[model samples]
Target: MRRLIKLGLGSLLLLALIWVPTSSTEATAQSQVSEIPNVYRGCWFQPEILKYRVRMTATTFTFGGGYYEQKHWQPIKQQTYRLSDQVTAGTFTWSRSTNTQGYHTIKVRGGAYHVKVSQGTLFVKQIRQGHDINGYELTFNQISHAAQVLSGDVH
Candidate 1:
């Protein structure tokens, strides 16, 4: 009779362990959207005022012109830009132009470019140009969600 009682207790403990994770996971998934609000709600890039800068480079290229964003051409002003780890250091070139009338084109090198931003997620495109090889694009995302998992904010 003692052996049977022990077996029943073990079974209950096992069930509890299994059920805890499944229920917590559901709760975590439901709360993820509420954590970040309207992160992807607008036109991410404003080409008219292309504010940007580069660091740890020999030379700097400024975009003193107008560009296109969402079918409109607007003036671009130079500003300081920050780069994440995803941006590789090397020869990089970027151009901005509108796909409509009154378009503007601006190009720059020796700096990083902002590729995409969505759902509180940001991506920086890195470029490396060489002989017989032009360049390549690399995308990066935030891993802070992993920290939330450790803190019990996510399961």
Candidate 2:
């Protein structure tokens, strides 16, 4: 009787410990979402053009593309950009300058390039090889059509 009571109490205590952490983690996640900038958080990449979709999330940002060249989706190399809290509004551009000789290469990169973001509009300009790429202006609306595609809401 006493042993049974102790066992039940121990089980309840263990359950409470687990439940507390889980609930706390969930609450913390919810709070972060509220604080996060209202931006697209999902897999996005351009398929028609060689230019890949740049993705940003709470923890990381990645730019890459997939090609179905040989009957398989092959993932291209991606560049990761780190974000700082100081970044308030602007377009972030990224580029790499590489010097290659005989299959050896060195890469120099820049990113989080400031542009401007207003009213949920992201305007991006392209820079290639230390020169601005001509006639290339990329824009993304905050309410993306990509989400519909991802959710199978689009045909």
Output the number of the lDDT-best candidate.
2
| lDDT for each residue of candidate 2 in 1-155, tens digit (9 for 90 to 100) | 99999999999999999999999997875453222133434444444555355566654455556444433334578655444333233322222221231111111244222223446555444445655464554564443565454334666
| Segments in model 1 whose C-alpha atoms lie over 4 Å from true places | 35-155
lDDT of 1: 0.36
Instruction: Report the number of clashing residue pairs per model.
Output: 3, 2
**Ten contiguous residues minimizing lDDT sum, candidate 1:** 51-60
List TM-score per model, in order.
0.24, 0.38
The 0-to-1 C-alpha lDDT of every candidate, in the order given, reads 0.36, 0.46
lDDT of 1 by residue, 1-155 (tens): 99999999999999999999999998886443221123322222211233222111212222223443443334455342222212234222322333233222112244334343445443334332421122542222333332343234555
